[model samples]
Target: MTIELSVLVEEADRFLDAARIQDYCPNGLQVQGRPQVRRIVSGVTASQALLDAAVAAEADAVLVHHGYFWKGENPCVVGMKQRRLKTLLGHDISLLAYHLPLDLHPEVGNNVQLGRQLGLTIEGPLEPGNPRSIVLVGAPAEPMAPADFARHVGAVLGREPLLVEGDRPIRRIAWCTGGAQGYIDQAIAAGVDAYLTGEVSEQTVHSARENGITFIAAGHHATERYGVQALGRYLAERFGIEHQFIDCPNPA
Candidate 1:
């Protein structure tokens, strides 16, 4: 079953509420292609490898969490950027991407999906009364020691996470997926036992140590893989179109 590209893009934007959120990059339809869409390839990033895979799969469109045209990126389209755009334009494949919206979304967001994978029962947002709050507070099914929790995260994400153990076992914890280590202070203020995010900065370790809250730095790419896959499945189920999620693994 094929749907028009415009219809697909419109529904995706509306579903994610993309226009309302302020993000580093545009949220939807970064590249436009064929008028009719039958297949979509979803991934965490719009890397050249993923684009190549999508082309090989004969995808009509590409969906991702990361797309081109960042706020501070060089506007010139001469080198790598040109190559990536050329691939999509050459093959007539549309690119649709969502960033903060995909993280803040209640159902298929990255944070929610990561919590589900970790067996966490989310209590609420880390920052209450903020509509765009991406950090979330939740508790695992059982309280776990920092080491045990780190092992569990490694098993689930297929990558050994960096752990800074605190004074106590993790009971209430806060998490935000993908390079949100800056939110540790906020999580600490929330009085949680631990904080988890995709990347860890140098200062993050000190903050966790001083505050006596366990900190886990799961890989950025590892943690964000699920949201795009979930969104792809949702669109596939909704529109009765073929959707494939290709993982071009990133070690970071």
Candidate 2:
């Protein structure tokens, strides 16, 4: 089955509620392609490798969590950027990306999906009464020691997460996927026993140590691989089109 590029884009944007959220980059349809799409390829990021794979797979559209043109990126289309855009334009493949919206989604969201994978029962947002709060608070099925929880995360994500052990077992925890170490303080304030995110800074260790909160830095790429796949499945089921998720694995 095939659907119009514009229709697919519109449905995706509406489904994610992309317009209402403020994000670092545009949320949908970063590149224009052919009038119609029969196959869509989804990935965690739209790296050159993923794009190449999409092209090889004969995908009409590439859907990803990370796309081009961030808020502070250089506007010039030269070097790497030139090649990426050229590849898309040359093959007439559309680019559909969602950042915060994908994370904030209730059903197929990264956070919610991550929690589900790790057997965490979601409580609520870390910040009460804030619609834009990406940090979510949850609890594991059973209270686990920091080391045990870290091992579980490693097994699930297939990457050994960096763990900063705390004094107490993790009862309540907070998390936001993909480079959200900055939310530790907010999680701490939320009175969670642990905090988890992708990519940890030097200071994150100190915060966890002093505050007695277990911390886990799961790999950014590993933690975020699910949301885009879930979104792709949803789109495929809705529009009766083919969808494939290609993982161009990144150790980071």
Candidate 3:
């Protein structure tokens, strides 16, 4: 059930449209190791613990939503980066990562998967005018109260979300996973009843209160756990390769 590393990367790149978009970090194939991948480990982030799990699972490739080498990060392979890279190289395991592209993907994307799990039907982009909007808007099949909606998100993601109450019922909602509080303005502009994101900022409260939009800060890791796993599932089915998703939880 081994597939060539090149072939797998190519397929992922094509599926995610990784090249066309500008991202802070490189999208596909962050680290190259084994030429052929028989087993893959997928997770939210490429943290040390997750890498250890991948090694323990004997995974030939490790795929994740978050990977190393950001836009303005230090280029030196020192400290944590060095250790992580060492582990992958030592085990001959490839590192494949996708960030924004994974979030925006129509199928198996973070927002879409999370929305489905929460019984939300997709409406459209959160920012209707932005062609490359990673955030998405969705609605429950039946509208739920603000508090009830928060509970539903917590239940689905297994993380208690911090609810910032708004004045009205939440029918139309928008979300972007993983520390996207900065996009609250876009969500507000979209005129949704509520906005959900991973991390909350100091000003988020003001935004929510002023705009009368319910704000839910679901855990960054919690909200993001699905995209990579979904991609892994797709890869397993498409390529006949074994894939295991290792959950590495983070409270924030």
**CA lDDT of each prediction against the hidden true structure:** 0.95, 0.95, 0.92
Instruction: State the lDDT of candidate 1 residue by residue for 140-195, as single tens digits.
Output: 99999999999999999999999999999999999999999999999998899999
Question: Clash number for model 3?
Answer: 0
Error of 2 at 244 (Å): 0.6
The candidate, 1 or 3, that scores higher on lDDT is 1
Rate residue 7 of model 3 by lDDT. 95
Q: List candidate 3 segments past 4 Å from native.
A: none
The TM-score of candidate 2 is 0.99
In model 2, the runs with Cα more than 4 Å from the true position are none
Compared with the true structure, what per-residue lDDT tens digits does model 3 show for residues 113-194? Answer: 8888888889978767776888889888887899999998888888889999999998899988889899999889878999
User: 156 in model 3: Cα distance from truth in Å?
Assistant: 0.9
Could you tell me the C-alpha RMSD of candidate 2 in Å?
0.7
Over the full model, what C-alpha lDDT does candidate 2 score relative to the true structure?
0.95
